[model samples]
Target: MIRTLYIDEMNTLHVCDSPYDIEVTPKWLWVDMSEPTKEENLLLSQFFHFHPLSIEDATTVKQRPKYKEYDDYLFFVFHAIDLRTMKPEEIDIFINSTLIVTYHKEASEEVDKVWHTMLNKKPNEKVTTNEVMYKTLDAIVDNYFPFVYDLEDKVFSFEDRHSVDISTENLIDETFDLREDLLLIRRTVLPMRDLVYRLLEGKVLALSKKQKIFLHHINDHLIKQVEMIESSREMTADIRDNYISLNSFRMNNIMKILTIYSVIFMPLTLIAGIYGMNFDVMPELHWKYGYLAVWIVMIAITVGMIGYFRIKKWF
Candidate 1:
């Protein structure tokens, strides 16, 4: 999908399909493309003079988060977190004097919302492209908190439900999965955070006063997002440790029970072994009264052992 916006005035912006060009004032124009093809790439390169290396990275999926300063533009690659599954999708953004291009391997809900907000109004009622960019970045950052909060919630849920029946394997896997997602989010957010920080710090030459103010707003949002990601990562680590401790406790309890059972039965086993031995000269085997005496003795021994175990609190 490709969306092009040409902003001429505050309320009047033009929306067009991709693979097309128009000459407008040195105003803010934003173009977004997803899963571009060879023909689309060729068209963009012809019109924008985008660097070959930047185009290569844009075309390839799963590029790492980075920033490349070209002669006339800034190329940035970042990932958007998928809140439902805690995965990251790579997104590429390029900015020059009058044009901003965004490339993505998959659809971003935040991007789509920003695009619609830009195009829904008449040209005279549209917002500045810079402001639109701010909103786009803001939306992406805004989404991060919800995902991080959800991960935190999951960690707490796991900790609260710790039990012997719960499978440690699954819990550990989930903790690692949450941690991986937080790391991916951090990779994207941290660089973008730095970029916004530079803008807030007045380091970028491309931004005008109005654009800088808008970028500063985006910077604040990014800062919060990065903090949330970091906090969530820590929460996952804590949950993992809790799971380990719970499992160890359960194992120790099981071993204690088995050991106590073995100890309690040792004396009974010894007495039974002695009686079962075959000996023709055993005097008790031929006496009728002796059989009764042996039964009484066995009962007495069993009761004594039970009382001793009770007194020792071994149960």
Candidate 2:
């Protein structure tokens, strides 16, 4: 679907569902091509001097987060995350002086946000394409905040509740999952920060001073998000390490008790071995009370070793 919004020089708002129905004027314009068909792609290609590679990138799904500068326009592939599943969503944009176009495979709340803003925003005298582009990217970044905070909350909750009487295996599994999510979010955010940096340094779009400052502010926010994600990742790592260490400690205790049992039984087993040897000349074998005496000695050895272990607190 193609949706076009045109703001006249007087900042009048005009909304059109069909791009052909709306006539382009000499004013700042924002064109949104959502889940565009082949015809829509060709139409957008005609409207702007979009390089073939840029057009392909725009149409392509699952593109990595990146920014490409062309002779006439700046192209961006940005990723947003799903809070529920922690998957990445790609949003592609083409920005130039007079127009801005966004393409996505699925319907995006992020694009709708910018659309609503451009429609509802009261531009007093004039609105520039840079402003619209900034709004577009800014909305995408804004949507990221919720997912970031949700991830942080989950990590923090896991950290606080890890000591609860839950299954240690489950704890480890959850922490690993959270780490994967943090890594995924980081993958999206860091590149977006780089994209913003490239935008700030590049000559395309001709960002005005006001627009640059606005973008810088957004860039700073992205940096903070990256930091939060890193911190969450560390938390997950710490949880995993703690779980491993605890298991190792438990295993050591088990081995210690087993070793103590072996040490206590060695002498008793040796005594029994001597008595069990079949020799007709053995004096103990001939004694009538020899069997009773051997039983008594084994009993005493077992009791003595158990008492010793208790005293030493070997457990």
Clash counts for all predictions:
8, 0
Q: Assess every candidate by TM-score.
A: 0.74, 0.88
Q: What value of lDDT does candidate 1 attain over all alpha carbons?
A: 0.74
Model 2, residue 156: displacement in angstroms? 2.4
lDDT of 1 at 175: 84
lDDT of 2 by residue, 1-315 (tens): 888887766667788876567665636667788878887778757867588888877776468878778887778888876556667788888877777788887788777876776677765656666776677678778778888898889877876687674688888888888888788778888988888888788775566778889999989889888888888888778879999899899899999989988988898899989988888899989899999998899889989989988998886
Runs of candidate 1 with Cα error greater than 4 angstroms are 7-13, 18-20, 23-28, 83-86, 119-130, 153-216, 226-251, 287-301
How high is the CA lDDT of each candidate model? Answer: 0.74, 0.80
Q: Which stretches of candidate 2 lie over 4 Å from their true place?
A: 8-12, 23-25, 46-49, 201-205, 299-313
lDDT of 1 by residue, 213-258 (tens): 7777777778777777777777788888877888898899899778
Backbone-clash count (model 1): 8
Best by lDDT: 2
